[model samples]
Target: MINWFDIRDYGAVGDGTCIDSPAINRAIQAAAAAGGGAVCVPAGIWLCFSIRLASHVRLHLDAGAIIRAAVPGAMGAYDLPEPNPHNMYQDFGHSHWHNSLIWGEGLTDIAITGPGMIDGHGLTSKGPGAKWAKRKGYFPESMAGMSAAELAAEDPEEAAMQGQGNKAVALKNCTQVTLSDFTLAKGGHFAVLATGVDHLTISRLRIDTDRDGLDLDCVRHCVVSHCRINTPNDDAIVLKSSLALGQVRPTAHVRIHDCHVSGFDPGSMLDGTFRRTQDKAPDQDGMTGRIKLGTESNGGFHDIEITSCTFERSRGLALETVDGGMLTDIRVSDITMREITTAALFIYAGARMRAPEGTPPGGIRGVRIERVRATDVDPRFASIIAGQVGTPVRDVVLSDIDITYRGGLAALNVPVPEKPDAYPEPSMFGPLPAWGLFIRHAAGLRVQGATLSTTQADGRPALWLDDVEAVHFEQVDLNNAAATPPLVCRDVRGLTGEMVP
Candidate 1:
């Protein structure tokens, strides 16, 4: 009924010493040539450089099978990155698919389903910023006149990844893809980078990685479920709509549910260690493993739902559409979080405008987040909703939110900046003026059934509003640390609320 091609039948030696990617690719090609079938990778340590995938092929890895990615230029090297003149729009990793341990582009009906492990020990990965600026012809003023060798010595990982692959799995412009039931360990830069894909389903994946767990960029009609992702360095499951495909393709109609995101040390989740050994990420911030949307908002996000997720020792849920991408019709519910480094909930819409020229700044509207419970969260940025001066965030709702902040701040009237073109991080604004809720440059925001408390007493007001209109609060209880002035308002219009101190 169906064709099956085993790697062993195609001269594959899974001895850990031999480079078996060529043989694995042969089996995939054979399965593809046979009009669609499964390529079997049985139980063994199949050391590889890069294993390319094809259309209509299902790469099935049996239990105990391990596809370990060797260091580039150690045994063999991965495919060279394809040329992209539009790479300056996004990071270098998001622009290329070929330079990855497993990659596919412009195909259909492909899947990678199994319980096997992908060990990415030797791969190198680095995110955007000045470290990757050289790739995009951007050198900061800090490195004024450093020699090439000195630059290489400064950031050795960048030098090591030159002409090498850094991703675990990368797919681009494909349709009808499925990835499930896999254990991904130490995924280099990104465990999975799926850009411009449609009808994608990722489920039951346990990813404990060095960097970002999943980067879904400009994808459409996708569903991610039952995954446990741990990334102490970067985001766990981030939905981005970047200008990678040289077009404005909004990531729409996505549903993510029943997932667990954490900030445990790399490889500790699989080993059951769950250690907090690693202190800070490359950005010198606390562990950043959370489900987020956008810092790359070239294309907008529409009609997205995230429910039944848990966050452990990580950042909280964030909605950031800085780079000129509209965020609308999004609903998040039933989330539980602990040990949050940033805000329990952060929403931002700014005017970074990193897209092509003449692109207008985007705004956020019609968002509903409810049934969220967070504890031991940092009070420096407690639940922020902010927008630019001219472009205000609109029509958002936060319901049934119970948050306990680990508060210890003694400042009032903290001057906030209007960093319209700055990066959109929860802590971008240093030490929010409010201790519980900070709302600015927004309209039509409703907060109902919210119970806010703090472990330590805070000096600021429980609720602070600035430049907002039509804001209504019902059944709000600021329990222990509701300041002397429970509510503070500045330039607020049409505010109606009953705040219980």
Candidate 2:
């Protein structure tokens, strides 16, 4: 045996059934103080509170080793020191406390690697008195009883909602990290969230959670590959930038490849909740599955490449720039999907971020989706919808796509007027319906070698395009058993189709 044991030197023991966070953290801190080394959690189930990792330390769990959270209330035990300014809300938006199951900050060369399991006990910790439950409402209960300074001194979760506190693993402001070959189960929020980290690689991991499986926010130069993520609440893998009031720089240069994601809950998935405003209109809820980009993206993304992936039983592929950020130089190819409930692919550019009273609108540019196939999709949605809300989606391209719809195609942009005698103003908008292929409010779009087929009892068009510019459709085939048009185009300029009309 390699004797990777650190207990004899700076020991901490937990049997996976008892609270051992203090001992383990003490040992880790001791090792870090004496110049960094590995903290070994040998094969056993150790019940623990959240343990903070130090710089240059490795938390190695051997096979059969399981470290589970002790109880929900134990999270506030090692609350991080409050930031200066003594004002409770000074660091409110950027603070990292009260949100992570396993968290670390300002570390280097840190890892939690093993062929073991880290069960978050998410279902056990979901409701009130649970971490996530406290952050559900707009104002936290803890904030009511404390002054601003006292709230600052307390953990960030004391002031924040329970919804923001349910992440399983969070690594903030760290660099040179690698997480591989592990299984993370039942995350309260995101299974793994890495923010403001550089040179990170996450691979060969299996994450099964109710919330987002892997959420990479405000990070740069990272690679994720060879992973399997199954969640029921949100996107399997998500990349986002800071969407709060302050402007954190965008996360850039991200690459994701060779992953399998499915079985996600499409109804409750959402992004960009941090940007919600009281003045803005209410959001329309829909099913989201597979890959998604911001409803919270304020930090703009660039140089992203996704290749060789599979999506199963997802709502659809959503690339939304609603939060006033720019997404540029993005490429997706060689993807396969099954049982998609909504559009196969959707790109909206008219996503505007709620600026601080007086800022310019944000938009998305330079997007591409190629060589993708979707099977068994609901016909009410389209194979693709690429356009902006009011602005135009620019420089978009779709090539070599084969899609089969189980329902008829519909439109996504039909405006719904509010009833006059309703509640003063419109409380809801009608569904933005779509067809097999719906492209609206876009510029410089090209669709080549795209194929669509419908198996629904009702006959409807296989494709629909509205308010598009400079669109080219080459070698397109729409196979349907209905009398309706196979393709519908409205207000499009320079549209060329060989077999699409």
Candidate 3:
């Protein structure tokens, strides 16, 4: 029998109104005092402020147990965010660790398991730029005097996150952790924010959140498997290498597989409703939940593998290292996407050196993606592989891919700008000139056995290349547009390919 340290034995009343973090902390302390054991949080509504974690402790929540984050007020408040001098390099939410519902720093051999729920309904999720998804493009006049049709933007107001616990579970500088078999609802800014942690395994969790589902930054030797993440507002599962730990720590040797990422209506996944409520464009409010890497690539990424994942009602896969990080040796395969909103695949390398002022531009090399099948994808943006003028993305291979685009858009005559310092997004350069694939500033690219098709008879070329070097294709079926060329090449060198209609 497991000698569980029950929280109820330590003056924890499992009522919804009472603040139970002190009792829970006492239970954890007692478990640590006894040289580590399981801590039992039985079934009830346990309202808490901040629950700190210790080493070698497994918090097992029973069935129907709910650890709801308490509202910050006279009743109680969470721990204040410790000052981070390196806070200027990243967003405000990514800098702090202690201002969370459950936080741990510098611990070892910890686990948070069991089939319970963490409902962060009262946590602070006040998005400043736009309102919720209801008014997709409507902006109030109070939003800096901009009207509804302008599509205005605003910088994040950091002072607005005053005393609000924005993350459900936050860990920093820890090791040998496992989080499994739980349900997270309404996670405020990020459901789980893990940085500088190693040997972490996150599996079999259902996360339906408002913003990012899992933000793994500066982590090493991690495996994320068998998780279903739904985030309608931001990224679902992202790997970043921010300068959050006050140093350059690379995220390496990561493997993610057997996961399902989506962008559905909030609270629909948990309630089993599974509704697709947002009807606007992908950039508006509801459809950005895709697997990605970096907008904070300070330390770089290496030896990452992603396989056997499904995407639905979401944006397509993206790989980015714009903040001066080397993204290399990425292998992704066996992916299927349906109802994709934007580009089916996007790879970019830029000179956004968001690190300490002198960081150089990053490189992307040795990426192989195979057996990807996407259907009913957006037509405005194509799968793009782009780099800057001198530093081009190198050595990419795409094989055995099939994609179907909803392609009613007419090709417009416009020059695609190389936004070297802009945010790395698939839709960064508006409507692309091609309907299938667009390549720019790349080297040593090989495409084999691709079947690109469109539903609505697009007017753009199937393949467009510019300023690229050493391109090769084999057994690729290009679109047969009437009186339009199947391929458009400019400033390209050493092109050797067999293309068929």
The C-alpha stretches of model 3 lying farther than 4 A from their native spots are: 126-157, 280-286, 479-483
RMSD of each candidate?
3.2, 8.5, 4.3
lDDT of 2 at 17: 47
- Candidate 2 Cα misplacement greater than 4 A, ranges: 1-11, 73-99, 122-165, 264-289, 384-386, 408-434
lDDT tens digits, residues 121-196, model 1?
Answer: 7677764333223232233222435677755543454334555767999999999999999899888788999999
Candidate 1: where are CA atoms >4 Å away? 127-162, 481-483
Candidate 1 has its poorest 10 consecutive residues by lDDT at: 131-140
TM-score, per-candidate, Cα-based: 0.94, 0.80, 0.94
Which candidate has the highest TM-score of all? 1
Q: Write the per-residue lDDT of candidate 2 for residues 1-501, one digit (tens) a residue.
A: 122435434445554545676777777887687677777877777666567877777777778877775555544332432342312211232334335557887788888887777777732223212132212222222134456665443344433443333556778778989888877777655678777788899988877766677878778999999998765445788887754224546778989999987764321222212121211101122223377765446677888889999887665677765445688888999999887755678675543333333444466688889999999975655654444445777888889988987864333345533221111101112233434666667878888888877776435456667788887888888776666656677787888767654
TM-score of model number 2: 0.80
lDDT of 3: 0.85
